[model samples]
Target: MTTAPTRFAPSGPLTGTVSVPGDKSISHRSLMLSALAVGESRITGLLEGEDVLATAAAMRAMGADILRGDDGVWTVHGVGVGGLMQPGQALDMGNSGTSTRLLMGLVASHAITCTFTGDASLSHRPMGRVIEPLSAMGADVSASPGGRLPLMVRGLAPAVPLEYRLPVASAQVKSAVLLAGLNIPGVTRVIEPVATRDHSERMLKGFGADISVETDADGARIISITGEAELKPQTIAVPGDPSSAAFPIVAALIVPGSDVTLTGIGMNPTRAGLIGVLRDMGGDIETLDEREVGGEPVADLRVRHSALSGIDVPPDIAPSMIDEFPVLFVAAAFAKGTTRTSGLDELRVKESDRIAVMAAGLAEIGAQVEEAEDGLTIIGTSGDMLPGSAHPIASSLDHRIAMSFAVAGLHCRDGASVDDMHPVQTSFPTFEPMLRGLAEA
Candidate 1:
C-alpha cells in the first residue's frame, strides 16, 4: 500500500500559459483501437499517465507490437479484428474504469478467457453495467458479490449483436458495448437517453469502422456499427484534457487578479460543459484560436478572475460534463447565491461517490451544501473564507476528487488538505507540478 500524501497551498494568484496532458479518454481509445487496427498506427500527444500506460501494456501483452519513439510518438502494430491472443497473466487495470471496462469489451468478442483485477478502490467499483450488456452479446462474465471487480470474462467468437438502450449516461458503458460489437457478426446498436462524450464513436470512425449516429424524436441518439469491419492504421493526435484543465481554471477564477491561458484543450461539445457552466456564472473566459485537431475541436482558453453569480445548472447537461462535477462544485462555492446541479446520479458510481464526498468536504470547509438523491446544491460564499476547523478531506483514492478539493483550498480561508493523492497518477501525474507552477507565476 502506498502511504505518502501531499498538500497544496496557494498563497496568491495564478498566472501563466500552460498545457495539460493529453485527453485521458481519447488516449485510452487511441491505444486500444490502434492495437486492433491492421498495420502500424502512430499516435502523438498520447497521455503517458498510469491509466493509459496500463492500457498500452495490456495491449502489448495481448500480442500488439507497441513502442514509444524518442520524439514522444506511440506506434502500435495491431493483430487485426478477432486476432487478439489470450494474455498469459491477469490484467491489472489499476484505478482506471475506462481501461477495465473497455478492455472487457475487447476480450468478450474473442475466443479466450481473461481474469482482471485492480487496486482496492477500483475493485469496489460497479462492473455490472458493462457486464450486463456484454452478457447479452453471448459473453460469460463472473464477478464478486454486488458485481464488484476481480472478475473473469470468457469471450465468444462470432458473438451475437445487441441493440442496447442505456439506463445511464456513461461513455465507458457505451464504449464497452461498441468494442464488443467489433467482433460480432451484424450491426450492434446503442441508444443513449442523453448524449455522453462521443470520443468512442469519433475514435472508432477515425479507425475506419462502419459507424453512424442518428438522433431520435425524443432527443436520444441511435448509434449503429457494423461488426467485424477491418480497422486500418491511422495517425492520431490526442488533445489536452479539459477535465484536468478545470482545476487550474477554477483556481484562476477564484484567486484575485489571476489570468491564465490553457493551450490546445479538447473542445468536444460533449465535454465542454464546464466552460458552459462557468460562462453561465459570468466568468471571465475567452476562447482563442479555435481550431480542429485530430477530428476534435481544440482551443486556447483565456481565464481571468471575475466576480461570479450562481445559476441553476440543468440536469440535461450532466452527460456533457460528468467527470467535472467535483471541480464545478468548487467554482460554485465562490459564486454568489446557490448553484444546484441535478441529473447527476452518474456521480454516485464513479471512482467514489462524488456527490456524497464533495458535499461532505465542502461542508467541512464551512460552505453551505445540501446533498440530493441525484445531485447536490451548493450555496456560494462569494469569496467568503471557508472555515477549515474541520479535518482534512480523505480523497478515497479518487484522482478527480483529490485534485478538485485541492484547487478549492486556494480560495478557502484555511486552505484545505487531502489525505491521498496517489490516485492522481492514474490520470494526471503532472497535476501537482503544473498547479505549483501556476501558483508561482
Candidate 2:
C-alpha cells in the first residue's frame, strides 16, 4: 500500500550501535531447505520483512508446517524431498524475485503444478533466465508474454538431469537449476562462468545434499548435485544482512561527524564487495572482531565520517555487490573527484530500472551524474551538501532506491523526500526507525 511521502532531513551526527535485519538470501533458503528436510528445523535471526515472509508463506502452502514462536524462533516441519503437494491456489510472491525464481525451481521437479504471481513491480521483471534451464529439465512452462510473471510450471516427476551453463551471473537462476536437481534421478550440473553468491551451495551441503563445486581449467565453476537425496534438518542462525547495512554505513560516512557501529553483519566474500569499494574510496570503515557465524564469516563494522575520494569501480566485482549500487551511487555523490562504474547491466532489470531511477533521482538533488547503458559516471560534490530535491523523489516501488536516497538526504541542504516509503517494508522494515534512533543518538 502506498503511504504519504517521507521527508528525511539533515541531522546531527549519527552515533550508535545497531544490527540490521537477517540475510534475506539466506533466510529464504533456510526456510526452503528446511522444509525439504526429514525432520523439524529451527531458525533464528530470520528476516521478518515482507519479502522473506512471502517465502515462508509459499513454503507453508506447499505442505510444509511452519510456525513462529513468541520468542522469534521459527520452526519448520518438512515434507521431505520430492514431497511437495500442489497448492490450492496461485502462489503470491509479493514483490520478491528471489522467492519467485527459487520456488519455481522447487516446483519444477515435483509432481505438481503451480502458478506464480506477484505485485505489479515484480510482474514487470523477466523470469526467462530461470525458465530456460528449468525447461531443459523437462518442466513445462506457460509464462506471460516476454516471459514475465503470472506464469505456470508443471513439474515432471523423474525429471531429466541437465548440464547447463549460466548465460548470466545470477545466483537465483543458478539456484533454480540446482534446486530442481534435488529430486531428479541423476546429477544436475551448472557451470557458472562468473560466480555469484554461494549461499545455495553452502546450505545444500549443510542439508546433506551431494553437492560439489570445482573450478575448471578455464576458471568456470562446475557445481554438481545428485538427485533423490535425503535432506537432514539442522539449526540455522542467520546473520545480519550486509545489503540492509549499506544504507546506515553510507550515512555514517557522508554525514560529517557521524560515527556508527553495525553489529554482526554477514561478511560473505560474495556479498562484501561494497566494503572493499568504499575503503578504496577513502571511507573510514573498520572491521572489528572477525569471526564465523553459521558457517559464514561476519564482523562488526565501525564507520566514521571521513573525506571520501572517488575511484573507478572494477566491473568484475559487480556480481558480489549488485544489490548495493544504488547506495554506492549516493556515496559517490558526496565524494571528491569522479567515480566511474560500468558492467552493471543487471541494475537495469532490478525492481526499478535502478540505473535510470538513481541517475534521475541523484540529478534532481543537484549531483553531477552521467548515465550510461551499463553504468554511471558520478562527479562528486567534494563533500559539500547537495541542494535537496524540491519535490519528492520518485522511489519507483524499490526498497533499496528509497533507502539510498533517504541517506542522501542526511547531507542535503534542504533535506530529501521520497514519494513512497512503503517499499522499504519489503526488505528493511525497520530502516526508518533505525535511522531515527541513530539521528537521536
Each model's TM-score?
A: 0.98, 0.99
Cα lDDT of model 2 by residue, 1-441, tens digit: 548898899988999999999999999999999999989999999999999999999999999999999999999999999999999999999999999999999999999999999999999999999999999999999999999989999999999999999989999999999999999999999999999999999999999999999999999999999999899998999999999999999999999999999999999999999999999999999999999987889999999998999999999999999999999999999999999999999999999999999999999999999999999999999999999975999999999999999999999999999999998989898999999999998
Residue 90, model 2, lDDT:
96
Candidate 1: where are CA atoms >4 Å away?
Answer: 2-4
Report the number of the highest-TM-score candidate.
2
Pick out the ten consecutive residues of candidate 2 with the lowest summed lDDT: 1-10
- Candidate achieving the largest lDDT: 2
lDDT of each: 0.91, 0.96
lDDT of 1 by residue, 366-435 (tens): 8899999999899997866576533668888899999988888887777788888888998888998888
Q: What is the Å distance of residue 205 in model 1 from its true position?
A: 1.1
